[model samples]
Target: MINQVSILGNLATAPRQEVLPSGTVKVSFLLAYNSYYTDRSGQQQEKAEFFWVETFGRSAVNAGKFLVQGQQVAVAGQLSGGNIRLENGSYRNCTAIRAEQIEYLSKPQSRTADPDVEPAVANVEF
Candidate 1:
């Protein structure tokens, strides 16, 4: 079965990076998607949904370096589910998108105004 999934959303939190015991790089972030609908009373309603996204290897490194909170991005990947251990020592089931491709929909806010510095790449896929 095809497990492809794609989403365009804003980053809710800055990407977090970690190195696994096996020495692989991992990055994760929360994405927020907004939707609008017409209510029965003819009023417009807006709703937002959040998703957890994860990337590995080269993509993970790029995401950690270039992505920032509130930045718009498009992600293409597959849904993955696993259990995560909580601080209380209990494990909870979680679902996340395993990103294979990420495209920056909007330019990241520059941290410096130096004209000599290079800009972040707009699209990354691995």
Candidate 2:
């Protein structure tokens, strides 16, 4: 079976970054999308969905450096999930997207004067 997913949404939260014990960089954020439908009464209705997304390596670094809350992005990846043991000695199942690629759909409103900071590029894939 093929396992792939592609979504376009706005970032619901700022990307959070962490360094693993093995020295790999990890970044995670929430993506939100809206669905519009017409009800039986002919009234328009909208529903929002949020999903957790994870990125690693260069993509993680770029996401941490450039992505901000409410930024639009497109992600292509696969679904990943596992059970985690909580501090309360209970196990909980979690699901997330393991991003293989991320495309920035919107550019930042402003740029820093720091020359070290790279300029934001449209449709950048990482």
Candidate 3:
């Protein structure tokens, strides 16, 4: 079965990065998407939806360093659903994306480093 999903959205929050005990890296972030529709009364309506996205390994490292809140990003990944327990002890189904590839659609100008300085890529390990 095919389980791939792609989304282009703005970052709702900053990316959080962590390294596990096994030395694996992880990054998590929230993405916001907007939908526009025409109502029956001929009025335009807009709705926003948020999704959780996770990346691992080298992708996680890049995401952590380059992504920030309000930046536009394009992500291709697999969607999965899980059950979350609420504070009232009720179970709720939640969906998230396990990002396999990510692209920066829009980013702040300051995010770029000085052209005179070379990026250190030799030290980065996958």
Off by over 4 Å in 3: 82-93, 108-126
Kindly give the stretch of ten consecutive residues in candidate 1 with the minimal lDDT sum. Answer: 117-126
Model 2: residue 60 alpha-carbon error in angstroms: 0.4
Candidate 2 lDDT score relative to the true structure: 0.78
Point out where model 2 deviates above 4 Å. Answer: 82-95, 108-126
RMSD of each: 8.1, 9.0, 9.8
Q: Order the candidates by TM-score, highest first — what do you get?
A: 3, 1, 2
RMSD of 3: 9.8
lDDT of 1 at 117: 57
Estimate, for each residue in 41-117, the C-alpha lDDT of model 3 and write its tens digit. Answer: 99999987767788999999999999977788999999987543445667656578999999988763343555554
Candidate 2 worst ten-residue window by lDDT: 117-126
Error of 1 at 82 (Å): 5.6
Per-residue accuracy of model 2 over 1-126 as CA lDDT, tens digit each: 899999998886678899989999999877778889999999999987666789999999999999997788999999987443445667556567999999999854444545565432222111
**1 versus 3: better lDDT goes to:** 1
Cα lDDT of candidate 3 equals 0.78
TM-score of each: 0.74, 0.74, 0.75
